[model samples]
Each structure stands twice: as C-alpha cells, then as structure tokens.
Target: MGEAYKLDCDICAYTENIFVGFGLLYMRLESIASFVQDAALKRRIEEFIGNPSTRYDAYDALYVCPVCQAIRNELFIEMESDSSQYKISYACPRCASVMQQEHIENNVPVHLSCPACEKGKLKATFYMDWD
Candidate 1:
C-alpha cells in the first residue's frame, strides 16, 4: 500500500481522502498522464490496431473549454462537426455550442471548477464504493 492524501476543493468545501489503489476515480487520467514516450504510446496504439483480433467501435478523444471548463468529448461529436477529419472535435453539452478550436486538446485534467461558480453556480462531486 502507498500513502494516501486528501484532495480538497476550497470553493464548495469538497474533500476526498484518496488512497493509492485500483478503482480510483482518476485512474484513466493518471494512466494517460503517466505515459512518458511517444513510441510507447504508438506501440500501444499499434498493438490495439494492428492486431486482427482487436475490434474498436470508434476512436474517441476529449476536449475542454478554457472559458467555462466544460467537458466535450467524442460524445459531443454529434453536437458539433468539423470539416477536417484530422482530430476528434467537440461541442459544449452545457452551452450547446461549438467549442473553440484552441480550447480543444487530446486530453486534459478532468477536474475543473464551473465558470458559473463565481456566477453563483454550485458544483457537486460524488463518490461510491464496493459494498
């Protein structure tokens, strides 16, 4: 076992005692962020793609708005469309508008504050566990 730590959100007084283990909320983000080499990432992609047994329904990516910090992923592809086929585009689900190009990224920090928080918005966080 590793050391655990507390993550606190000052705005809403949100606090979580996080332990270093499996099934954590940010596992996906941590795993992706831990990737050190482009070649390793390429190899991982190749392993999934080059293998004839592999079956992917669709390739997905994520994007976020710098302004509102709203998340827009491949799911938002429907909400927005791009003429270029290069990158997965997104539309703000909350705003129902296209996110600016510069605001998009392949990946970003999942946790962020709501823009409306300062505008009197309340953000909620939830945690569940195995019984």
Candidate 2:
C-alpha cells in the first residue's frame, strides 16, 4: 500500500501534498514508463519490461535540491539489468543541480529542511493509505 502526506513548514507556512510508495498500477511496465515524461528515460524503462534479469523499483518519493534547496515530489525509479545500472537522478529545475532523495522513516519524512525558507524543518502529516 502507498501513503499520502501533507508536508508543512510552520515558520514559512510552506505546504505541499505529496503521495509516496508504489501502488498496484505501478506493477505494469507500461504504467511505470508512462510516469516518466522524458523520452530517454521512458525508453530505458520500457527496455526492462518482461526481462527476467531486470531488477527494478518504482515509487513516489521526495527529493531536495542541495544547491538550491528546492523540493520536488517525483516518481522515483531505479533498475539494473544485464550489469547496467539504470538509476534515476532528478535535477533541480531551478538550479540545474543534482537533487538528493529525502529520508523517510516509518513512512514519514524525517530531518527535512524547509525548501521555501531554509530555516525551518518540514513536518509530514499522514492523510491516507493508497493502493
């Protein structure tokens, strides 16, 4: 099952509703590939479909840009097939810097700094279960 969260920053009043985890629909290769808007990324993911040796994981995840302190909720996908790594890394839309995955514990994000203010921590509030 997947989960949804409302992340808020008390001091800055920054807020965002995000969904995390893979749902049943994510099991299909076509479904997963569709989530990727980049043509190159979509092609790479499609190649892994139905391959016995292909090992992959797909989920909704939170990413933070280290350079710009921007936050993004994105579909996270990683795969390894035929000794080739297919890890997905997101670039900060604002700064063009490589973004880092945010830490989550017990389905809740932890140690997250507010991307808006950069002074307050983010609080994750669970809203519901999905899939």
| Stretches of candidate 1 exceeding 4 Å from the true structure | 1-8, 13-62, 72-85, 100-112, 119-131
What are the models' TM-scores? 0.28, 0.87
Candidate 2 achieves a global lDDT of 0.83
Error of 2 at 37 (Å): 2.2
Residue 57 of model 2, lDDT score: 87
lDDT of 1 by residue, 38-115 (tens): 554434434443334433222223344655756433211111122212223455777666664322111232254434
lDDT of 2 by residue, 2-81 (tens): 88888889689899988888898788768878766889988988788868788888888889998868988888888888
Candidate lDDT values, in order: 0.36, 0.83
Task: Please give the distance, in angstroms, between residue 45's alpha carbon in candidate 2 and its true position after superposition.
Answer: 1.0
Off by over 4 Å in 2: 106-109
